[model samples]
Target: MRVDAFDFELPQELIALRPAVPRDAARMLHVKGGVIEDRMVLELPDLLDEHDVLVFNDTRVIPAQLEGRRGEAKVGVTLHKREGLRQWWAFVRNAKRVRDGDTVEFGGGVEATALRRGDDGAVLFEFLGDEPVELLLERAGTMPLPPYIASKRGTDERDREDYQTMFAKEDGAVAAPTASLHFTDRLVEAIDAKGIGRETLTLHVGAGTFLPVKADDTADHKMHSEWGRIDAATAERLNAAREKGGRLIAVGTTALRLIESAADEDGVIQPFEGDTDIFITPGYRFRAVGGLMTNFHLPKSTLFMLVSALMGLDTMKAAYAHAIAERYRFYSYGDSSLLIP
Candidate 1:
């Protein structure tokens, strides 16, 4: 399908620069079949049933943005994927000045050498020390905010806590699973009290998630790989929930994609550990995930395409129109929507 079909006009003021206070105070638009209801994140417990399972991505966002100097030239790097313990694939700004084998010196004595360039225009950087790269980043990096927000303002101490979710434990993601950001301990307790089961999996959302789709057609757009893992025990528990007639509610699109990638034709989820570039578009049939709770996405973005696939394209368009008209916030720090097909 044409990528233009997913395009919509969004007012500049609608983009959220900061998250709602208390997290659960964020607005949530419930899209059940064709019905739409405006609600708050705190009301999520009432929307689910005792037999439903909510799957959350436990991957934590890292300080992936680095500002460095290669000789006299300034280099901006956003680490997208981990190639090794000390090596990462990064999208570099001022790429023309950064050649392969050039040492980019970040502040506080941290440095990484450009090893090679990937086919997707990203540069491979190998850290030059024996200490863990995570430690190096702690000294020389900042949180990797989405460009939509970053372009408007600078990242600050507040974003360190705001960009991460309560489920954050395993560290690897460059981008936050925005949908999970709306969850708080209070909400989790409420859901648990309501008898809704919660499960967790890891999907290190990369900076590639922020990349724009420049293709005219959906078939031509390529998704950068993101590493994810679903252990056997979790898979078994999810299968058990399904056997008991419990619906699997993916907390975010990252969880939804990872589960769908691991599901078989029979709709059984299996243990998985690896990279997935699963590009979900219209006409794709979902198997493992029954419902999705996610943030509002950009125009012509893969996320919008995935939501369109979940609900019909026309349905999603109408839903988005309703969201815009209702003045719900948009983007990573924005409001959320519960999409049930």
Candidate 2:
């Protein structure tokens, strides 16, 4: 399929620079069975059932965007994917200047070396100090804001909260599990009171999630790998829910990818801990997810492709058109959509 086949026009005004005031006040577009219905995030309890189990990616967004000096030359790095506790695959602006063996020092003397460059234009990094990257990011890095957002008031505060989901606990993601942003404790209690269960998984959403489908042919585009994990306890409970004939719903594409990656051919899911570059395009067979909650994605992005895989391409196109006409917000910190496949 051509990547251009999935392209659509979105007004710049629709790209949300900030989240809605109260999280649950954001809109929700329910797409099911080739039909679309408008709704609100607070209506989650009414939209779902007792026999449904919602899965969320609890992978926290790290303050992974860092500004540091490489021998007095200005360099920006976004630590989007982690290889080991101290190693990472980072995207560097003006990366050509910082070739192999060069070191970048962050706040304090803590530093990381440019081990090399990868095939995908990512810089291979190995931290110089013995301390883990987790601590380093927390101490020196700022929340990695999306490129589209331009901040003037203060760059620090909004990103700290906006770029993280309410349920995020595990730290790894360079980006937030967007759909989970629309949720609030009140809404969660409502869902729980309605008898819907929620489970947690981890998928360190990387900066690659924002990469455009550079190839005109969507099939030719390569998907970037992201680390994910499912604990044995969560795996057991999800399997139990399946056995009880409960519907399994993934809260975001991150959770969807983790669930799909862990499920076996028999539709049984095992605990997982690894990276996945599973590009979910149209015609791909789905094994574990029965429903998905996600934000409107960029045109020709892997996310759009994933949504196209869930609902047919035509239905998604029409639904997006409806969203555009309705003046719905788009992207991270944007409104959400629930797809019942």
- Best candidate (score: TM-score): 1
Q: lDDT of all the models against the reference?
A: 0.95, 0.89
- For model 1, give the RMSD to the true fold: 0.6
Q: Clash totals for all models, in order? A: 0, 1
Query: lDDT per residue, candidate 2, 24-118, as tens digits?
Result: 99999999979899999999889888989999989898888888888779888988888876889999988977999999888766689999899
Q: After superposition, how far is residue 138 of candidate 1 from its true place, in Å?
A: 0.7
Per-residue lDDT tens digits of candidate 1, residues 249-330?
A: 9999999999999999999999999999999999999988889999999999999999999999999999999999999999
TM-score of each: 0.99, 0.96
lDDT of candidate model 2 versus the reference: 0.89
RMSD of each: 0.6, 1.6
Q: List the residue pairs that clash in candidate 2.
A: 3-218
Model 1 pairs in collision:
none
